[model samples]
Target: MSNPNYDQILVHIIDYVYHTPITSPRAYQRAHIALLDSLGCAVETLAHSAEARAFIGPVVPGTTVPNGFRLPGTLFELDPVKGAFDLGALIRYLDHNDAYPGAEWGHPSDNLGAIIAVADWLSRSQAKDVTMETVLTSQIKAYEIQGIFQMKNAFNKRGLDHTILVKVASTAVIAHLMDLTEDQALSALSHAWQDGHPLRTFRQAPNAGPRKGWAAGDACTRAVHLCLMAKAGQPGAPSVLTTPRWGFYDALFGGEEFMLPRPYGSFVMEYGFFKLVAAEGHGISAIQAAVELAKKLQEAGEKVSDIEKVTIRTQKAGKTIIDKTGPLRNPADRDHCMQYMVAVTLLKGEFIEGEDYADDSPWASDARVDELREKMVVIEDEQFTKDYHDQKVRSGANAIKIELKTGSEVPEVVVEFPIGHPKHPETLGLVKEKFRVNMQKGGFESATVEKMIEMVEKDDLPIHKFINLFAKEVPLKT
Candidate 1:
């Protein structure tokens, strides 16, 4: 029989998280919106054809956490691990999710990897009675864990995707949900330590496409598997991050534990941006710049030909990732290409998903777009760079100051915080809207969509029931 000793510890932690009330308002608020936004992402992404389906999808996504925590649209019940991966992937599959500028790691909503998987498995298979409170607590705990680890953790710098943090956080949260004693929690962490992180090859060029979005889901899957093993009396190695030789410090982290410029708390969730578009983070600034400039030129009734040049100054990440000057072969390239977003915005006077760049129908390479691009010089602004590094005000905001052949320079407009900024407010309303949009995109009926919004808002819903709602199996399009 499975060792009851390990099981008890796991069960206890899960119980505590499930029962604990959320006192932090920000945590509670973030939970509600993230719930909708994440669900939406899952709905929209799972709607696509490229997604893998059925057969061995998630036969028994474990059980034990709480009720109402089901994988949206799919009835293939699963362990929390599978649930986490599925839900996390669903949410992140679309590039439209919340992010933190301080997180330099793409998006923060990726935590769904651990939250969904662990919660479902514990409630379903393990016979745990998880509740809304439990989900919130665990969600917060996982967010804190991931965000804390992210303070100084530069995964991309190490050529690893930021989703590694999701794995770490999810592992910790899973252990907590399992009611693992401190020792058990630590043990689960050991497994995480033992398991190496994947290279960021999927987030970069050529291969840098949809996989970048799914990397977080993959991490959650690994987190659940490790947690389960730990709950089964598996041993873990200590000092995984600092060990000599093959240790993470050398083999992975390069002999450094992350340096925290600030404490890990609700900070990440609060400041994280909800991507209004699908392009990578670095390109946001450039896109904003292009959009701003296009607005002015268009208002003047001027064509792209009248434009003298388009110049963009951005951070190192933008330069390294999206600053392309060639044929954008696919949507993946088009998404990140600074010129593409800018060019499309200028020519069409708008940038929408279907119009600007879709896999099937692509915008032809226009000389006008190129003309603006040729004259466009992108450089790094020293002050903008400084502001970006300021811990107290960490932002992914961009400043655009453009000049025209008309001999007048457009006023430099700076956006320290984009829409959905936790500090800027209205995030809840925005997130709710986004969630509805996602559900609609997934083709969810009005009734199903309304039920989800109501359930999430009450915060008293069971994890299993939540699962059942999503269990409708968001169908894939041909």
Candidate 2:
């Protein structure tokens, strides 16, 4: 095997799968969830925006392939590359895609657009039979590619975006699933290298809106495009991420070489999260811990009005990104603001996905959320901070402590990881359910989704039939 130290993750994963055996019950489970949730997000956002349709809709007739992943609300049966991006953009249009928490932000599940697009397209268009096992295997490999990279690299600090990892991870995984030769996989990596990443404008304010969600899918879509080109004798720029002056590390990453916390494996796939609520950023963990504490206080008969101050101690990442103080201007801002999210959850006993962000949050007029925001002092817990840096860990840990006006303080409720953490019981079950429910709710209810999930899990399903099902028509937007 080639030395991984010198290999980009895209190249390294291809080489690793060649030599090692990788699969598990957990890996298979996560694959199903990743597919379902991503599709659900895609379907939900399909009719909501024109940018989504304008960008992703071309995939259908653009490619010669008739049977491919059927993007909701459109008739495009795209080639794998276009399919990946189309699907990615659809799911991510609202900035609601999944995330991998760290000192620097990482979106682990972003590559799903690429993985599912290729898997869906290949199984449908080509005679290649895709099974649950193959899909699971692909998910695991993709997760490892994205997750392991996020463990050490801080992309945002260098003025780039996290979707760059999506590009690398998706390209390598697609290359592998297509059964590309080792040389071909390396070529795909080169394509990924030359495929430049978008700026971080999508994640920040003023301009910060829904684009952050689909950015990864965009990266993945291009990944499939490059891989197919390489298969057709197209050349790739091998040192795309690491050329001395114009390479990825220097051009985008502040000249810092990509440092991986671990070798590629099924580890990341096992631990990915499904965003139950729409606000998916640095607060997945803190939101859970604080929500739990809020419920406990509410159960104790303490009204939000009686709450004088709320103190939340957590890893610095949660505070730095989501921890905001002021009048939130939009849904994007409200979702990320620590005090606002916690306050809504406490006030209504639930977090509304797309409620009154334009007008005031019902409690928006309530001085209490702000009162809570003011009383809330976000401090970094040393242990939480320490756990966040550990390589073995994926999501940054979070802890919340609340103080009430009644002069009684409950024991601090600290969630080591959010509900979506790999170790958490909810990650697998909730993620898949979230996908199925959201998709059905969005309008593309079909037998194909179940068959697709089954194929991903058991590896014995007839992949062509599944792909053909996507070609079947559904309700069009009126």
Candidate closest to the true structure, highest lDDT: 2
lDDT, candidate 1, 1-478, per-residue tens: 2223443323333343434454678777777777678667766666653543432245444443333345666655555666666677767765667666543455667877577656666666556777776777677766665665565567778887778777777787777677766666666766675776778876556665656656788888888878788778887665555567877768886776566565445555555567666556666655655666668767766656665656676765566667777555555566667766766765666544522555554465555655666666667766666666677665666655666678766666566655565556665676787777777767778898899878876666667567667766548574
- Which TM-score value belongs to model 1? 0.85
Global lDDT scores for all candidate models: 0.64, 0.66
| Lowest summed lDDT window (length 10), candidate 1 | 1-10
| Residue 432 CA displacement from its true place in model 1, Å | 1.6
lDDT of 2 at 9: 55
On a 0 to 1 TM-score scale, where does candidate 2 land against the true structure?
Answer: 0.83
Which stretches in model 1 have alpha-carbon errors above 4 Å? 1-22, 49-69, 354-357, 364-375, 401-412
Quickly count the clashes in candidate 2. 12
Residue 326 Cα positional deviation in candidate 2, in Å, after optimal superposition: 3.0
> Highest TM-score, which number?
1
Off by over 4 Å in 2: 1-11, 17-19, 44-56, 59-65, 72-75, 93-98, 297-300, 351-372, 391-396, 405-411, 443-456, 467-478
What does candidate 2's lDDT look like per residue over 62-171, in tens digits? Answer: 46457756654456666676667777776666545566655456666667677767776677666567665676676677677777777777777776777877787777
